[model samples]
Target: MDSIYHTLRKSNPASARILVRKVLEKNNGNVSKTARILGISRATVRRARDGELNDLSRRPKNIRKKMDCFLEKLIAEEAKSTGYRYRLLSYYLKNKYSIECHPPC
Candidate 1:
């Protein structure tokens, strides 16, 4: 019952085509009923039936921060023992190893 629309993947032409085909079969080749039941536009269902879906590979575009294994393990141990994190963890790292983990900026 949510009105919000969330697009996790921007492009999914191949899946769209497959879905239209299955729904079409279920609805006995009725495009209008298929689109209505699937909550999609009739044009979309028509395009899918017209073989407009392409097989494109979708890949993640997110970047992750790199952390040293030793430093990460040490941080985990310190957090588990003292429950210090973020700014406090930065303070401990700086005071113990003389390295600035998180700058004020």
Candidate 2:
């Protein structure tokens, strides 16, 4: 049976890399043997050995926001002119513009 690393994914890169290093040491730095044990490719084991172990962000660079920029600007403008807090701004947006807004915490 393969090790848990074969099925497990999106693991913390730093921790994974550390584990890879320890396993490599135990196997006397054999990349092929280490890869088989970890259930990963030899290249992957090599990458971990080469020290590229930082966790990559799961969040995408271009995220779709619930409130678009235009609406956010409008809310900001209203808040600035009216000197109203987020609660009041939220209320005004709901009642006057018929738009639902949850003020950012």
Q: What Cα-based lDDT does every candidate model obtain? A: 0.70, 0.81
- Model 2 worst lDDT window (10 residues): 2-11
* Among all candidates shown, the one with the greatest TM-score: 2
Give RMSD (Å) of candidate 1 vs. truth.
Answer: 9.1
Off by over 4 Å in 2: 1-3, 6-9, 56-105
TM-score for model 2?
Answer: 0.45
lDDT by residue (tens digit), candidate 1, 1-105: 411111211355566577778879888989898877767678867877886567545665754655688888987887788798688978987888786677335
Best by lDDT: 2
Residue 32 shift from truth in candidate 2, angstroms: 0.6
Cα error, residue 68 of model 1, in Å, equals: 52
Model 2's lDDT to the true fold?
A: 0.81
